[model samples]
Target: MEIMLTPAAKAGLDEWESNGNKKVIQRIHDLVESVQRTPFKGIGKPEPLK
Candidate 1:
């Protein structure tokens, strides 16, 4: 499965990294990887957009 971020999300991530939130950025990447590995059973509960 592929994960694509919206433009706003990309900008927010960039801003977070630029503001020295490397750890948070890494955690986001980790979560993405986890979701990729197990879409319905990863770190956080998976929910539908509704």
Candidate 2:
């Protein structure tokens, strides 16, 4: 699944983090990192030349 935040979600995340919600910030950061590790769309080893 593609993990992402919409503009509104991003705005809310920033606002909440600035409001001393470290736990929420940490969770979101963790989620972002996890998603980053996923392979990009169609990423794979090259096919053999027949």
The TM-score between candidate 1 and the true structure equals: 0.76
Pairs that collide, model 2: none
- In candidate 2, what residue range of length 10 has the lowest lDDT sum? 39-48
**Over 4 Å off, model 1:** 47-50
lDDT of 2 by residue, 1-50 (tens): 65678999889988988899788788768666655675332223434458
Which clashing pairs does model 1 show? none
Model-by-model lDDT, in order?
0.88, 0.69
Give the per-residue lDDT of model 1 (tens digit) for 1-50: 99899999999888988888778989988898999999888887888678
Candidate number achieving the greatest lDDT relative to the actual structure: 1
Error of 1 at 39 (Å): 0.8
Identify the leading candidate in terms of TM-score.
1
TM-score for every candidate vs. truth?
A: 0.76, 0.54
**Per-residue error at 9 for model 2, in Å?**
1.9
